[model samples]
Target: MKQVCLAILTALLALTVVSPASAQYIWLDKNNVKVYSDKAPPPDIPNNRVLKGPRGYKAKNIEVKYTDGTEPPAPEAKAASAPGTPKPPMTTAEKNAEFNKRRMEQAEKEKKAAQEEKNRQAKAENCERARAYHRALQTGQRISRTNASGGKDYMGDEERARETSKVEETLRECN
Candidate 1:
């Protein structure tokens, strides 16, 4: 643990000492936000748009061009990115954003799974009720119910048929 802490302190000291000695590029991003980096801005960015660049590397040397107005770059370049131009390591803010994005995606997946389980349970319940009602109708026994006026009423043949059809529809949907 002592060695680990010492190593971390040394690394941090090295980084702080190295960073200030490096040349930095400054420009406004597409969102019109000022950005500072250790790399040059995109080639297409206007020379005037580049607020600053490495020492002895004048920003006015840039030439803006758009090929899309005529033709696109070869697919090979897009498929196999140019070699030796490795992407820079992610910054702290970028790492945090990526972590948040993954976390939100996982949450969304869990939410969807929970909803599907709830729907499945509801469907099973509906199927069970429909099956029970179908069994009762098939018995052909007189089915009675209390009317809205609190009087006992019996189901007629037409009412039974209508109910059977409705239950059949519900069964079909549940299945």
Candidate 2:
């Protein structure tokens, strides 16, 4: 029995030591949402920032490897320090034209961003309003159906109409 126990222990130890760990990379998508996976992105995707997995299985142990794909030649000290570039002088008219162009571009970008935000908010609000309307309808139907007594003990037709109108107002606000 002791020999069998020893063999079992040995087998467990071997299993523990035999399996090696692997690493994985993680990054955010276009929507600024985080994603993690074992595979690398394809070449067509811009910014080939590879997240190098550690020698272990856990993602937390992964290291960020910024391999910019392009090969860099050996650097020379003299070429780096040389400030041979000259800035071109701009006339007042040219400067004003450039400023106006940049202002228009910035305004256009802001407008598009605002429109996208508005659309997202409208969608969320519409969903909420629709859900509320559905719930009210369901509740009203349940109240009306279950109370099948000949006497009018539940909400009258006028009250039901008011409730429906309120829900419609909420939906209109979403639009």
Note the clash tally of each candidate. Answer: 0, 0
Positional deviation of 133 in candidate 1, in angstroms? 0.4
| Tens-digit per-residue lDDT, 115-155, candidate 2 | 99999988897869677765877575633434556664666
TM-score for each predicted model, relative to the true structure? 0.51, 0.31
lDDT of 1 by residue, 36-136 (tens): 88888886566776888866865544433576675545646843675644455689999999999999999999999999999999889879989999999
| Predicted model with the maximum lDDT | 1
> In candidate 2, what residue range of length 10 has the lowest lDDT sum?
57-66
Give the top-scoring candidate (TM-score): 1
CA lDDT of every candidate = 0.83, 0.63
